[model samples]
Target: MSIKDIDDIVVHDISKFRPQEDISLDSTKKKIVEKIKLQLKLNNTSIRKLAEKTGMKHPQILRVTSGENYNIETLIRILDALNLEILIKEKDKNSNDQLMNTAAL
Candidate 1:
């Protein structure tokens, strides 16, 4: 079945972004989700419009923005709807992780 046919598919788990402090997105993916939420708020974008634009269910987008777990395909669709993209580059020598951040165009 296609994405629409299986829109309810999901597996919930604790976020890897275990806060180092009271509030933080310590993981790269978590940071990206935070960025998406910020952009959506800045642009006054609604989940309804985003779902329509990306052909994804509202719950799917909610899962992503909530920093729950989401597959790459869902993330890509959301990024496309928000005019955003992920950027990858060599990690700094001092950095402990390889994952990078995203940018909005």
Candidate 2:
């Protein structure tokens, strides 16, 4: 099923589920880096090769790919090297399945 369909079908107050304590930016960055690495199959590339291709140090590449702390600049560089772009969108306030179906078409 499309993400929109799933989003429409599933009803939950995500705001309530958010952690009470502030989440560390490092943790958030690490999760995003790991997700991108997995999606792009970065692990298949050797550290030296990735470093050479991305113009980043081998250690930094390893750290970012391995879900360790990485700077935003590093993340952007890695994404650029992989020819990927990040998109940020606000969720629709209306939970309309019909809208989702139309969007899918």
Candidate 3:
């Protein structure tokens, strides 16, 4: 069964977890980098291991974890290696509300 929702409270749909109105690209990139580092530590995973899993070199992974500029494909590969995926959500102009394209990854 599905969980009950709180009255008068707006929440993101569990079936479609997404967000909109993201910050600037640079800021988002920085945030992603920070999150990756934290996830690595929390999961007790290391950059070297990630490098091996993604077929990337340790130095490149270091550059990514060190906050150096990286390409989007590289980011995707890194996250994929970590068993993570990125979601993209957009705002609906007609309804003036956020819409999540949670069809599938």
Q: Give per-model TM-scores.
A: 0.64, 0.51, 0.59
The CA lDDT of each predicted structure is 0.74, 0.67, 0.73
Please, what's the RMSD in Å of model 3? 12.9
Which has the greatest lDDT?
1
The deviation in Å at residue 72 for candidate 3 is: 1.7
Model 3 residue 30 lDDT score: 84
Better of 1 and 2 by TM-score: 1
- Which has the higher TM-score value, candidate number 2 or candidate number 3? 3
Query: How well does candidate 3 score on lDDT at residue 54?
Result: 92
Please provide, for model 1 over 26-100, each residue's C-alpha lDDT reduced to its tens digit, 9 standing for 90 to 100: 466678988998889987999878888898899998999888878889998899889999787975754433232
Residue runs of model 3 more than 4 Å from their true location after superposition: 1-23, 91-105
Model 2 TM-score relative to the real fold: 0.51
Model 3's alpha-carbon lDDT is: 0.73
Off by over 4 Å in 1: 1-26, 97-105
TM-score for candidate 3, residues paired by index: 0.59
lDDT of 3 by residue, 10-103 (tens): 8655433433433234456787889899889888999998898899989888888877878888889999887778988883464442222322
